[model samples]
Target: MKQVLSLWIGWRFYMARQSNRFISFISFASTAGIALGVAVLIIALSAMNGFERELEQRLLGVVPHGELTGVNEPIHQWQNIAQDASLIDGIVAAAPFVRISGLIQKPGGFQGLSVVGIQPDLEAKVSSIAQFMPKQSWQALAQGDKNNIVLGKGLADSLGLAIGDTLSLYTPSMGATKAQRIGAAKSHRFIVAGIFEIGGEMDLGTAYVPMDYAADILGLGDGVSGVRIKVDDVFAAPRLIRDLGYSQQQYMYLSDWTRTQGHLYQDIQLVRAVMYLVLALVIAVACFNIVSTLVMAVRDKQSEIAILLTMGMAKATVMGIFVVQGALNGILGCLIGGALGVLVALNLSSIASSIEQMLSVQLLSADVYFIDFLPSQLVLQDVALVISLALCMSLLSTIYPAWKASRVHPAMALAGR
Candidate 1:
């Protein structure tokens, strides 16, 4: 206990008085570097996390948590299938649907789009599309109005469509004489009943129509393409789908939102890892200064070390003193950096927006990116990992210097001084 106390006192004196101006300046620079590196890393990673969350929400808004579809035949008696599936413990809502690839043409232009045919009343119970529509109620589409259609905002923009604008759709239908592509290659008018925006790829490529109209166009007689299922917990979808007896061999396939958007999530994780490694190099450079500063301090304090050795101080105790001094610098730097990192991460969004406005350049573009706003989600685990890594590096920085200081012999240090 006395030895530890003495070592603490020695560290305090070295930091407070014996340290020269240049060493003091280097210490300040190292601390500032660690703080800046940590702060920037936290802010960047939090923003990436935010964007990832936004993508997930938007993706789930359009993609059903899971879908059970027939492979060999159009789903007959789908309402029964839906009813049976909904009775499963984790199932929230299940609705039959028909999906078709079609072309939408206006007088101004033409665009290709995926058309979803749904029972509008049940759609809101299963998906967020109803909630995201800007005009016309989901009930409007449910009324079985053959002429009505709902367009996604990006699809509307691409084809120059608006609410109440007349658009034409071209689709293939089975014929009595032969399997033939039917429906008007020319314009068959449809009224754009609503517009929706969810900031996802779906918004750029999809539209919704009533099931009856889709059946008429596609010649599907009371048959649906699939049943979309919403679950109480999205993460449990795969197991739930399997438990519900949906499989490839039954001429049925199941798809989940996670499968549909997993690529984006993986890409985000890869980019985050690469960015962190690049920024960590900054902290590594800062830690190099800790090594140099401690080495010079050891050289300058040789006379003091010799006197302590002559006074019967163990070599281990001498090593511990400088180790404690070096560790104090690291701990102080980490504390300051960790605190600053948290503050910056919490406010990164507003700060980034302000900077973008001041510069008159958009950093996040809605047209090119899934989301427009900067997002920050500071995870406790990420912060803890960063702090741990920085602390380890700081301790490692003291190793060689502390070892060299311990090697100083009483005779040589005394003779040299």
Candidate 2:
């Protein structure tokens, strides 16, 4: 019965429409502060989540998860090594590959490129190159057509290359004879088969050709530069590469995505941690408004508190009343903020696109940023955590005011009224 009475009093105090204007204003401010804090926190965290997803899907999707390479030369038995690696636990796919630094030239332009060689059919299992490439282009490569090659969109743009345009790929090396020193570079002709856009530095630096062509150019007689491995768990690639025993082999070496792309993931995590800390402070500051609101409420309701105590109200009940009242404010703020945050977070990408179109400005430039567009992904866990933190802070803020109200002497409070 006492619990029910305390709840009723708390509700009444919270719903009192005739309260002092200043007190009511402070209460409203408290609620609004909490709402703003929670909304901002949710939006920020959602953006971080979106960035991580983009990194995984767009960038990592094309890069090899792991690699097994020979120490001194090409892996001559790559086909057998690939077969062996694919049977290991956690490894989903393995494909032989060759990578070399080469220069690509058109009529009036030239650029350095990381030339990659892939078997189209086997490469499909290990990377998303096929998805970004046109159907006919990949099909041509799969059918053992050696005159074709694929270039990244940025690289193609730089060289003004298009499908069916012939380009020259050259690698500089020491000539075997003194007479050959004048032109100690080997050149190969290839038609541009396709252009792919992954929206990062890779698009500006990488090119692909058929594995057989690469073997001929690199002077590998039935050998590959390495075996690329794709695994079920991306984060475990480094450990999995070690488990494959490549590290123990005197003639082999192990490499994973961590070597090349781990810094991006680490930077994202660091930014996330800093944002969480800063936004949590925002919520904490907002909770201070609850303290202000409760303090004013206690002052205005002193006479009522005195009368209740005279009527045998327990001190604990007096404290419960304010706690309930302050908590209601926190709850209402969380609900409003959570709903708005979730709606915004889910559609942030579209919103950003609209803004960019209207303003005629690029928010995320591919050259400057890892991704080309803003992204967001609403996470229920983040929303719940924000609300829980706000509630805890709100409850704590009410304590001092509630205790002051409980300590009010009936004689003094009533006499002042």
C-alpha lDDT (0 to 100) for residue 393 of candidate 2: 85
lDDT tens per residue, model 1, 270-388: 98998799878888888787888788888878888898889887777877777677767777777888888889889888888899999998787766666566788999888888777
Clash tally, candidates in order: 1, 0
Model 2 Cα lDDT, one tens digit per residue, 1-417: 878888899999999924688878878888888888888889999999999998898888999999887778888877677677767889999898887777876557666778888898899999997888788878767644476788888778877788989878787763447676337877778888888887767788888888887877778878898899999999999988888755344477788999989999999999999998998888888888888888889988999999999999999999999988888888888888888888899999999999999999999877777778898988889989988998898888889989998999999998994
Candidate 2 ranges beyond 4 A from true positions: 105-110, 174-183, 245-250
User: What is the alpha-carbon RMSD of candidate 2 to the true structure?
Assistant: 2.8
TM-score for each predicted model, relative to the true structure = 0.82, 0.91
Q: Estimate the overall C-alpha local distance difference test score of candidate 1.
A: 0.76
Can you list the residue pairs that collide in candidate 2?
none
Error of 1 at 245 (Å): 5.5
In model 1, the runs with Cα more than 4 Å from the true position are: 1-22, 87-90, 105-109, 134-136, 157-161, 173-188, 232-236, 242-250, 276-282, 312-317, 355-369
The numbered model that scores best in lDDT is 2
